[model samples]
Target: MTTRRLTLRQPVMDDAERIALYLNNFAVAGNLARVPYPYHLADARAWLRTWRPDKPAGETGFAIDLGGEGFIGQVGYHLDARGETVIGYWLAQPFWNRGIMSEAVAAAINWYFRVTAAPKIRSGVFHFNKASLAIQNKLGFIETGAGNLLCLARGEQVRHIDTELERSVWAERQDA
Candidate 1:
């Protein structure tokens, strides 16, 4: 999906190197659950290989290109065994506070609801990552009182879980 400020497209092999750099930043890595501190190219290549876009229940990653800046971040949604679609994303530190992520996520969420009949998209943000929480709120995702523990890049334990956004609520927000 494409937006005025960003384009959300599938990850290409060439994106691995850039993604590895984005993943390696300690500031960016600290907010995510699985990204390693010193994320390597090999790790990025392995991740690219594991991606299966054709699977009925799978996670699809997208490169968030801010026109001239190449890929500033990545976002995606995956179907869990329980049939819930979980959304996740990470942006480069330099791109933070620019409203880029909000636009990318809004586009992704709209596309997901359009392509599939899923009623809602779920997201969990690490507690310390207030920026993520703000983004979710900006997207009209209400906290459903859910929370869980997640391991960070530094092997530090963090509580990183929350909220669900039903289609009805999303529609209402869009209408407003």
Candidate 2:
């Protein structure tokens, strides 16, 4: 899938270095639930190797790429522990505030809804991650409830605001 400034493509081994470099930053990884602090190339390699073309949309993701920059970030969804389809994304710090993440996530989610029969996409942000929550809100996601999710970087549970975007709602937004 392609966006105005990004190409949502599959991640490659060559991207492992870039993924590790960006994800190593606490400012980026701290907000995420699964990424550990001081992220390493091995982690990126392992994560990259997990991707398979045959996997369902919920188990696969897109590598966000720019024309000049090879890999800037990632966008996709996965099944949570409870077996719900959940969308997630992260962009390099240098690309922050550029609307790049928002664009990439939008494209990914759009494609996800089109290709699957999922009723809605589940997601949320750590309480302190207001910027990420804003992106979800802009994409038609609404607060579902609250919970605690473990942040590997923080080494503890953090307050999370759960949200969801129904397929019907997404369809309405697209029509508008």
Candidate 3:
């Protein structure tokens, strides 16, 4: 999927280097639930090697590509046990605050809803990450509740603000 400033493409083995570069930073990894503080090329390679774009189930990963800037980040979604699609995304620190994440998210969510029959997309932002929270709100995700999750970056359980965007609401917004 192409956003105004980004192209959301499938992750490839060669993207491991760029992925490791950006995700290695504590600042970028801290807000995420799974990525460890010291992200490595080996980890990136392992992840890319296992990615299945043709899979009938599970999360689909996208490498966020900036036209000339190369790979900058990732955004994707997977269905939880309850059948709700869970959205996840992150961007490199140098690219932060440029509205890149917001645009990538909008495009990903738009494509997700179009291809899947899921009713809503669920997301949780670590409480301290105000930027992510702001993006979620700006994209029309309303808080459903709060919970705690183990953050590998922080190596502890942190409070997370949960939110969801129903397909009906997104469709209405698109129509307007």
Q: For this target, which candidate reaches the highest TM-score against the unseen true structure?
A: 2
| Global lDDT of each candidate | 0.83, 0.92, 0.88
Residue 68 in candidate 1 has what lDDT? 85
Residue-level lDDT of model 2, residues 1-176, one tens digit each, is 77788899888898999999999999999999999998999999999998888889888899999889889899878998899999999999998998988899889888998899999999999999999999999999999999999999999999999999999999999999
All candidates: TM-score: 0.92, 0.98, 0.95
At residue 162, candidate 2 shows an lDDT of 97
Q: Judged by TM-score relative to the true structure, which candidate is superior, 1 or 2?
A: 2
Question: What clash pairs does model 2 have?
Answer: none
Predicted candidate 3 versus true structure: per-residue lDDT over 1-176, tens digit per residue: 78777888899998999999999999999999988878999989988888877954237868899999989999987776676668999999999989999999998888888887878889989999999999999988999999898999899999999999999999998999
Would you list the clashing residue pairs of candidate 3? none
Output the lDDT of residue 110, model 1. Answer: 86
C-alpha lDDT of candidate 1 relative to the true structure: 0.83
Best lDDT goes to which candidate?
2
Q: What does candidate 2 score on TM?
A: 0.98
* Higher-lDDT candidate of 1 and 3: 3
Q: Show where candidate 2 strays beyond 4 Å.
A: none
Let me know the TM-score candidate 1 reaches against the reference structure.
0.92
